[model samples]
Target: MARQDTPTNEMSLRWTVCGDRDVTVRGAEPGDVSALRRFIDGLSRESRYFRFLSGGQVGDAVVSRVLGRHDGRDIALVVTDGEEVVANAVYVVNDADEAEFAVVVADAWQGRGLGRRLIQHLQQLARAAGLRGMRGDVLSENRRMLAIVRELGFSTRRAPGDAYVQEVSLRLAAVTREAWLAHDWFQG
Candidate 1:
């Protein structure tokens, strides 16, 4: 996949998950820093460590980085339930043509499909940006996330230099279920 001038600025839209429930899913806006911080700070300690791999709060610079202030090639998404930020997901395209990703869902939002849906959305955005693949690093104990990505067609291996982390990756160009499922609208 070669880089093209594809616009990945997904418009803010209210998404109806099933037939009755509605959720606002949109690109991470500059004004969302406080909400994003609240979402992260509201997560359980275990979840925060799993998402950031650190006990310290993520600095404002990194938050702005993911919010795409430094690079438009990167993408971040926000999921809100009414006025509360419920989830955040992002992908940074590295020089290797692989989009490395990170996703976190609020404590109460766990067990729901928000994480999976956000990952699928990230995959679509990465594909449109001509990224060859998407990958993420998860703790060995994060069985839930491992299961989600595996079910979505990602394969995992032990991360180099780290015994407790698993590196999961999915090739976007491959003919796979997620590809069609995520972009079924134009898959002719």
Candidate 2:
């Protein structure tokens, strides 16, 4: 099978959160380095740790390196609100034809369903790129995240050698885009 190239065209998903707030999630660009930095720096200490899986200052050097490769490849997506990034998600494809994913939503934006939207968008992008599956490692304490992935058809297991971490994976081939999007969290 011929390997598929990463998606190149730009697609924007606009959604209204909290009934009155509007936001947009789209492909992360190289110019987003500074904005990305601000977004990371704005994350509460706990949020940063949850996203990075460790506790330490997320420095410019690290942000720059991350954006360096996020230039329209490897599936990087960000949700922006009026000028700042409120959420970020990415899924890097591996040799096994699966993409390892992660998502971080701003503390203030938590509980508004931003993380789920970001992951769903990332899955769409990855599936379009021919990835067979998507997976993420979540800290055991993050019950909300675990529940979200489970509701999206991802199966979870204890990460080998790490009891505190849960490895969750979804078989992208089994989910049709229409069906996936139809599982909208906005529905009451």
Candidate 3:
């Protein structure tokens, strides 16, 4: 597969998926802030809570940090259906080699592999940015994300928080350029 550098125009991406169902992944831009907000707003309450660890509310400062960080230290990708944003994934490098990741898919678009695609895309970005691995803290009740993590071969361990409350941390194996390129999920 060919990897193009991040696109300068958020809307100038060439759709790689077929059947007129456009799917292009790229870095977030200034113009995409509102669309990203709208997409986040469209997420189901359950999904929001699962991703953000809170009931459907995220502060504007957090949203802006995710959307406006064009530098490689932070990365965000938006998957659009025509003009509507349907899925999003973001990652921020925490240390020299580790990054934390989160993903959200609109309620209507769940179970079509959009979440998988977004994770794959984010993994590519993470590897490109020299991150050794990606980590995520997923709620125990979120089975969809758990399945995705397993499918991607992440080694999971229960994060030490309130043991009485349920949640687990998943750490994906080190992703190299070769490993990412060789991943079966990316092979057409």
Candidate that scores best on lDDT: 1
As a whole number from 0 to 100, the lDDT of residue 140 in candidate 1 is 96
In model 1, what lDDT does residue 77 have?
82
Query: What is each predicted model's overall lDDT from 0 to 1?
Result: 0.81, 0.80, 0.70
Q: Which residue pairs clash within candidate 3?
A: none
Candidate 3, 54-167: lDDT as tens digits: 776777777677673656578777777777887778887776566678888888878777787677767766776667778777777787888887797666666676442233
Residue by residue across 94-184, what tens digits does model 1's lDDT show? 8899999999888887876778888887888889888999998999999999999999999999999999999999998856798668778
RMSD of each predicted structure: 7.5, 8.7, 6.7
Residue pairs in clash, model 2: none
- Weakest ten-residue segment in model 1 by summed lDDT: 1-10
Q: Candidate 1 at 136: error in angstroms?
A: 1.1
Regions of model 2 farther than 4 Å from truth: 1-9, 68-73, 174-188
Compute the lDDT of residue 72 as modeled in candidate 2. Answer: 43
- Estimated TM-score for each candidate: 0.81, 0.82, 0.75
lDDT of 1 at 27: 83
lDDT of 2 by residue, 71-115 (tens): 344777778898889888877777788988889999999998888
